[model samples]
Structure formats: structure tokens, C-alpha cells
Target: MIQLGTRWLVGDEPPSRLPQPVIDAIYEVEGELAEQGVDASEWSWTLTWLEGKPVVELDDETTVEYDPETDSAIVTAPEG
Candidate 1:
């Protein structure tokens, strides 16, 4: 059983405070992924702001290896 959540980076500190609209969008996407038979534990989420717009990447079959010290994460999709 895999259960995970998304993490975001704002300007200085990581974006912990997601806007209401963004939160709703994320939840909607999460539900769609779950319905597609995505395992919760296999989730690796990345939320970033580019050009002052938010972008979200999610995958249940993909694994994101992250290092907290370096603030780096690698996203890889396993072969099905």
C-alpha cells in the first residue's frame, strides 16, 4: 500500500500554502489517477512555479527519489 503527497517549491521556502484553486485541481487529478489503478504509495509529486504559473506532475507508477539535504528529487517511471 503506497500513500504519498505532493511537495512544492515557491520562492524562498517550499510552497506549503497552496491556493484554494490549486488544491481543488490537485485533488481532482489525484482522484483520476487513483481511478486509473495508480497505487498511492507509488506517488511522486512535484509542484513548481514557472513564469508565475503553477505546474504539477503526478504519477502513481513512478518513483521520485529525493534528497532533503540537497533539495533534489529524481522522477522515474518504472517499466510496466
Candidate 2:
């Protein structure tokens, strides 16, 4: 399992796949770090667990929760 900052990602073949948005986020962060001449791989990292399965959700609102253990992001819709 690869770790970056406080976020954790699960790497597994079959069924479990990394989300594109998460990957984009990582890349974005990586790019920013690179611009500063800082290598994220060399920085101190927090402990994070990989997920065993993929969990996805679609919501009309912009709220979500990240689960480290499951490596999942739960999103909730805004109440009208």
C-alpha cells in the first residue's frame, strides 16, 4: 500500500480499483510539491491502510467523508 500525507490508498488487483479523482488529487499534490523542489516520497508520511474493495457514491451535494481503513470516500447530498 502506498501512502501520501494523511491519505491512504489501497492497491489490489481485480475488483478493487483506485478512483480517478483520488489519483488526480495525488498527482495535483505531487505536482505542487515538485514545483517547490520537494519530493513527497522523501517526506515523513502517516500510517494508512489499503482498501480491500471499491466503494463509490454519487451525490448532488459536495460533501464527503474519507475512510482510511476501507480506503473509501462516502459522500452525502445537501439537504434542501
Candidate 3:
């Protein structure tokens, strides 16, 4: 897991403080990417909150939004 500030990530687990929701989001995104044939080693995760919503940014293109209410991640891909 990756830890940045208060966000704990599964792919890039850093030695920082993080919350439970952020951790769950990282794992969720990791699973989703793996199902798509993307390995965890091929990417990184950054967790943050946007307007009180947990957002996980994968690499520089993909953004996964975590909804604690539904316990799911909403992935947003970069546009070409």
C-alpha cells in the first residue's frame, strides 16, 4: 500500500498516515485495474479528497473516485 499524507494506497503504499476509506479505495482501484490487465507494478496511486469525496488518481491519466456510501470506485479515464 502507498501512503501519501492521510491516504493509504495499495500499489504505492507509502509510510504515511491514512484513513480507512482511502485504503479501501486503493484496494478497489487496484482490483479494477488488474481486471483490465493492468498490473499494480505498472502504476501508482495518490489518494485525496475532492469536496469531501475520496479520489484516487492512478498514474497521471486515470482518476478513481471512491464513494464510501456504496463502497465502490468510479474510474475516470483521461481524454485523448
Candidate 4:
């Protein structure tokens, strides 16, 4: 079970309990960073649980909020 404010450690895989779409979205962001010549190897994924939903944040300030109703992650680009 996921506890509130659970954080995914750096260099580790994301929590399996999260939805598949969320997982894919996370990977996509990581890939994007890599393509942009950013070395995100040491960055971690931060998970903030709101009620039963998950709001994932990256070191680069990108956010991925899960929407169960749509079965997709509402990805917000990193704030500049």
C-alpha cells in the first residue's frame, strides 16, 4: 500500500501500484529529458497522494497528475 507523500527513490522504478498510463507518462517525460541532452540519471520521482489519487512531480518541476476517470495522467510541463 502507498502511504501519503510517498516518494520514488532515484534510479529506481516508479511504484507499481500506480496506473499504467501514469507509468507510461513518467517514462515519456524521462525520455524527453534525455532527448534534450539533460542528464536525468540522478533525478527522482516525487509522489504526492491526494485522497486516493496520485500527483507525481519530477526534479525538473514537471508534474503528472493521475485522473482515474479518464485513465490517464494529466501531465503539466515544467514551470519556467
What is each predicted model's overall lDDT from 0 to 1? 0.48, 0.39, 0.60, 0.84
Q: Cα RMSD for candidate 3?
A: 5.6
Best prediction by lDDT? 4
TM-score of candidate 1 versus the correct structure, residues matched by position: 0.46
Off by over 4 Å in 1: 1-16, 60-80
TM-score of each: 0.46, 0.35, 0.48, 0.86
Ranking by TM-score: 4, 3, 1, 2
lDDT of 4 by residue, 1-80 (tens): 66667677445788988999999998888878878988877788999888879889988788999998989888899656
User: Residue 68, candidate 3: how far off, in angstroms?
Assistant: 9.8
Clashes of 1: 3
lDDT of 3: 0.60
Lowest-sum lDDT 10-residue window in model 2: 7-16
Clashes of each: 3, 0, 6, 0
Predicted candidate 1 versus true structure: per-residue lDDT over 1-80, tens digit per residue: 33234463221222445444555545555565568875565445676554434455554444334433554444445576
Query: On residues 1-80, what C-alpha lDDT tens digit does candidate 2 reach at each position?
Result: 54332433222121124554444433454455568775445343122334533332212222333556665555444478
Candidate 3 vs candidate 4: the TM-score winner is: 4
